[model samples]
Target: MNPKKLKVLSLVLASLLFISCDKPEKPAEKKIELPKPASMLTLVPDDTIFFAGGLEPVPLKEWTQWSITHFNLSKEMFNPQEIQKLREEAKTDGQRLALQIWEDYLATLLALDTQFASWGFAEKPQLASYAIGLAPVLLRINLQDVQRFNTKIAELEEKAKVKAKVETLGTATFRRYALNEQEPLAHLIIGVDGNDAVFMIDVGIESQQTLALALGQSKPEKSLAQGNRLKSLQENYKLLASSLVYLDHQQILTGLTTKDGNRMAKMVQQLASKLKEENKGWLNELHSEGCRKDLQTMGANWPQTVFGYTAFDVKAKPSKVDALMVVESKDKPLLEGLKSLRGFVPYYSKEAVFAPAVFSFGLGLSVENVGPFLMKQWTEITQKQYSCSFLKEMQTDLQAKNPAAVGFATSMASGVRGLSLSLLSLSLEKKEGMATPMPKELEAVVSLSAKDPAALVQTVAAMVPQLATLQIPADGTPVQLPLPMPLPFTPMAAINGSHLTVYAGAKAEQLAKEMGKMSLESSQGFLASSLDYGKYYGLIGDVVASVDKKEGQQQATPQMLSMFEAMKQAKVRVQTKLDFTERGLEMTMDMTSPE
Candidate 1:
């Protein structure tokens, strides 16, 4: 109640108010800057292909976590801790010092980009993607420690391996290495400060003038970083991915028809000839003007950029793969048919469900229709029989099997809306290495959309005899009575509703199981994807695994053989899918680990 005490209390309250009004001192905010992919564009010229992409950066800790799970990459080959221990021990030792430096440097590598650039190709090259002649391929790697990286480079010559020598290009210095002695393959330019390095293939560097320009010493008036085409393309694909790939359709097509055009023509001719021989006159007169025009029209009418992005959601329970891709459309003649063509999407068979699932694919009515339509168009243009022999056989066989239905439909294709075919290789269970290449044995299965169950059985009974393979062996063997089609699907076919199915192959047992055990209505993994791109170039449309054991032992085609070898030898299993839509053709492919 005293005046002095009241004044003191008021002063204390005022002091408390002043303290509360002053905001609590906040911790300094850390600013994080993500690397701009646009900066990579600055490294290339305006004449650069629109197809360019790179890895999106993450915080260092997140990157370490992702690499451990995604790649299982560690500092050591067998054990990360052991590798680090050895590396640390080797650092001071004379004999292991070089090895230690290598280990240290390699562990510090953060990211790298491999870019395909056509700087020296013909100005109006017809086909660019097909430009295999020569192009500058840039390999850029971001590193953490510069000194160790430099040491790693210098110690390379000590391994008694291919010698690496230093060469100067304008203001830039390159450590050159040639797998081929006559011509060095790689001319690597390092950053002056050492956290980065650029590897340019020595193939396209004719003069020092362009090399200087590319090195950012005599900087281009306009940088690729300033370019809008690639920047927009990344945005269009929503390029927030760990990695991505893009194709320059404009440059590729131009290269194919331009300076490298002849090579392209020869390749097509060779393929056509081979296909005709194998399929029995299916691709007759392939290199003719009409055929060339057809091919040209399909390729020419698409967007310049076709891109694909891949990311992993490892946090998910099953760890799903989140792969997405986009292909821009064009106004082409076949575009209408691609969009309108409809039927079944690709199916993951019952065989796929239990059979180690090698590869399975289903194509719709639109794609099957292309053969007949092309046959008609090609026949009219070339004035020759351009029909598909397989389709022809299928038509005849279907007619013989189901007279009334075949008569109504007329063509096997007309009666058929789509074809579902898959190859499953069960190498996963087999421990023994294949002595020879696995054969792509076709399990001939006939699927018809007939409503009557009895009619479908009678249809199978008739087809069993005709579809059997009659072989006059090279060794003069007796001409045995024609063997009935080798299958459990003999005598009668199973009918579930309107769908009738039959199978023929050395390993046709799976088909028999599939017919009765797996219902036709249950088609999982059936991709009803749109066919937008005119044609896919990379790894799309090649998800086939050997289905039969007998087929696995047979000789394979060179391409099939190479792929099978990779499947057997390497842990890499590449998957590719090609789809059609009214908008454009779509192509997607990525490497996956064998399950």
Candidate 2:
């Protein structure tokens, strides 16, 4: 070869050698195979609510885009323009400097996920099953990593400014992250099995028993993984499902009989005991055998077990998302009660309720002729001991206070057939060049349908101090009445035949005057009491457009604006149904998008 050509060939060979020495970039496996031998279930404690999710063949960019679109935000990826905007919004030097700190934190998070996924986290450690289950006291999060994940974890911890301390339990060793002393002590457990599998446990307390359970030194007599009912629930979601969540209500409620059980109960009892010697048995009723049996019965009467599933079809017409919830109950009381909701479905027709609303929520409850049913259920829950004459005869409990008012409210709630609250406006709008934003006006209409309106009027009249009920009529214009709150405000209310209308707002005068215009009839014309998405989307769009016209939209960049425009063209509606079934109830929520 010529001298120049030989030199070039030598340089090329040297470059090739250097490239060979470097670690090759890996293409992440599309399938996520969970850890086995020590599977996610092995880490779960007894009587837990199990949940698991999987995202196979979906890129991070696409997942994030879906999230933004759901929130009605632009789907464009984060860019320097957003960072510049963040800096521009920083009003002080401290805030401006903190931007970089935030960037560092976010960068650290991205780096952690990338490094973990880059090392074949998804498919390297294949398990027979994967899950995330929540017990009464502890939560177990188990997943698999590459064989050499611990060394990488050590280096990352140093860079991330975290301190880790090691603790051993039998054959398993965990790295506990130390937090600030002032903060409540939380244990972060990271343990690896002999197999290339790792699972994490985040517990409020790290007692010897908890560690023993995770290390497989001891086993529970009855665990969620061993329960046939829970296994069936998990299976229900696993068939053509992307995720699964199983909840055993009866087991969870009954599982709180010991130290390793419910944390809330244990804390309450511990504090009560510490406070005084007299508090030794304040919670005796809760811990009693009868009370526990009643609790289990209550769980069976309601929803004993719940199974959930979520699936998506991106290629479907208008793209679709479907969710199903199977609520299993033996007594069928709750499902029957829920079935009574069909009468209230006709309460979302009026668009005026959402006219000036920035955000709003309304629910119409029907309790017509349900006084006996409610009293019976309450009696059953309380074991019908008439602890203190119960509510049937409240003459003893409220005799010191206003006995008549208490008695009336009880009766009124029992007789209430239809009750609805419509929250209208929630934003503070300022006039041009105003010194400060105007006082936020919270407008709402409360409607109640009772068997006897006159009795309620009499009770309400006695409750409000210095309020004259003589202004109200059987069928007349609504009148303003002084509210007994600390604020100087008077709302309007009226009793008309079987219904009562109450209009309340920050501007009492405006609300009082508008009371006659707003009526219960406005909400009673709809076919469904479910959320009114059409009106909600329209209101949201109007609010965004108004801001875009003045201060401009949050998406200032051209790319972001294009994404925002694209988001508007996709119409989405979600309808959730809790239909009563023979065994229990089937609650299904379907969300579909229209292009």
Candidate 3:
């Protein structure tokens, strides 16, 4: 062979040898299947049940542990001796009580199972046969009660015909039956003389023969007991159904009746005609007490259902004072009377009340969690002088859905201090395409005292713009102002005297413009802003304002980058300063780009 051919052939042969010698690739292994997770039952002890004369249920932790132990024992998955020892160590009176109740419940279930088996039924059958004999007895009793109540009501109506002033208040008749003998059953006094009144009107009722029988009434025999139960059920059903109709008619009357005397009378007349067709009577008792007349008079045209009593002392004639104008419900009447009698005195202290409202608004506006972030901003904005109530309420509300209103109120007041800052934070979070970093500053401030100041700042921030926007023009001055651009960043800053110094970068203007554009497009401006900032390795600052185009629409405002852009080809030097305060911690970073 030629020398060149030999060399080329040798190279090819070496390549083939290398390829052949390479380890054969192994086939992919089959994935192992995982077992499904066991079902977990969390037994929460209901406090309400404890108050309602029942033993509290087991605690969730204890129940969980018990279940695990029980499962292990039954399945032979754990040592019985070890499980027993653990149970002994954890024994307590409460635990024992809970176990007893649980065991009783199990026994009841077992007994029910056994009863079905005695009737030639399978254990744990899906459906058990009910006693057919019990059904007819219950039905007859409920029907009888309905007839009896109706007859008694009719008799009362006939007796009251001589003295009762029958007037209709919508579909319900206010039958002012001046009883000859005062009865304790007539606990609700309507007139000035403490005349007992029975609403005598049906609200609505639900009929259950079995339930009625279970409740029990005077029984003549086994059959009589069933008959009485049926009567009671029917009576209840009639009452409930009738009462609902009356309530509905009353609501309708509210719309029809108006301040215009003729219109109000006409509405009442029309409603009376409707009631007469259905054999129902309607009347309202009038007494010279507690602005009840005013409420009735006001409600003549008002579109709401109100019931209660009112009393008012005659200013010059104390002897002729009036005491009762019973409406339909107590709460509405009382509220109205207070308004009328006290010259519209605010129901709650203004300072105390407004805080919760503000807090509610903030809550409705805020994103979940991110407490530390809020706290940091609050400290910086308030200069550690103010604290946050809203944020605290938010944290509390988050943990406990139904936190006390008093705590919420206090939080609201604190939040008011930092209203502007809080709103700015909200705006920043809501802005299109903007991302807000978790506030390290707030966590630091809250850590200082366990009281978060950021909550107040966020509250104040939210309230400032809201109040400003809601402000009526001073003395008829037309409120004309230039529309503000949506602020992607919340205006969080350290207040030094009159100056507000915020963290922002050179590209703030560009970022703001981008955010504004995103806002117009109804996009996530904040998230977009964050992404843009990230591209340039810039940190976002406070949010100023976020405004939706509509009057009541949301607005977005946020702080953009404060640092110079990172050079594409060079390392950047960054310096950061962190300050901790009573409110929260704040971090400031100064970055220099390499030339």
The TM-score values for the models, in the order shown, are 0.51, 0.52, 0.16
Estimate the lDDT of model 2: 0.44
lDDT of 1 at 337: 51
Error of 1 at 75 (Å): 16
The local distance difference test score of model 3 is 0.23
Ranking by lDDT: 2, 1, 3
lDDT, candidate 3, 88-148, per-residue tens? 4322222222222223223322343332122221111111011111111110011112233
Q: Write the per-residue lDDT of candidate 1 for residues 1-595, one digit (tens) a residue.
A: 2343233223323322221111111111234322243454455544344423343432323323333344433332233454445434332122132333233334433221110011111111111011112334243333344455555556544542334455566555655432122221223232221233443433323325445544435644555456565446556665433243455555444433333353233333433444435573424433344444544554566645445344443344433333456566676555655554544433442222333334445554533354555544444344433243433454455444433332334343343344554443222221247533232343434444322434434444467766344332222222323343442223223343334444444343345344344333343222432211101211122323322346456433445534333323323233555566554666554434332
Cα lDDT tens digits, model 2, 1-595, are: 2343233223323322211111111223536544332244444544443333222112323333343355454334345565566555544222332343334333433444454343333322222122122312222222344355565545545544454665666776666542212222334344554443333333333346655665555665544455454345546554222234455565456544333355334544444454556665535555666556656566667655443335555445766666676677676665566555432321322222333322222344444434444544444544444332222244344334433343444555554545555555444455586533443454665655655656667776687657544456667466775655633333577765566667666442243234335444443311222333444544444344334333553524456445455544445555555445655766665566553
Winner by TM-score: 2
Candidate 1 has its poorest 10 consecutive residues by lDDT at 121-130
What is the lDDT, from 0 to 100, of the residue 465 in candidate 2? Answer: 53
- Full-model lDDT for every candidate: 0.38, 0.44, 0.23
What are the candidates' C-alpha RMSDs?
21.3, 15.1, 33.7
So what's the TM-score on candidate 1?
0.51
Total backbone collisions for each predicted model: 38, 2, 116
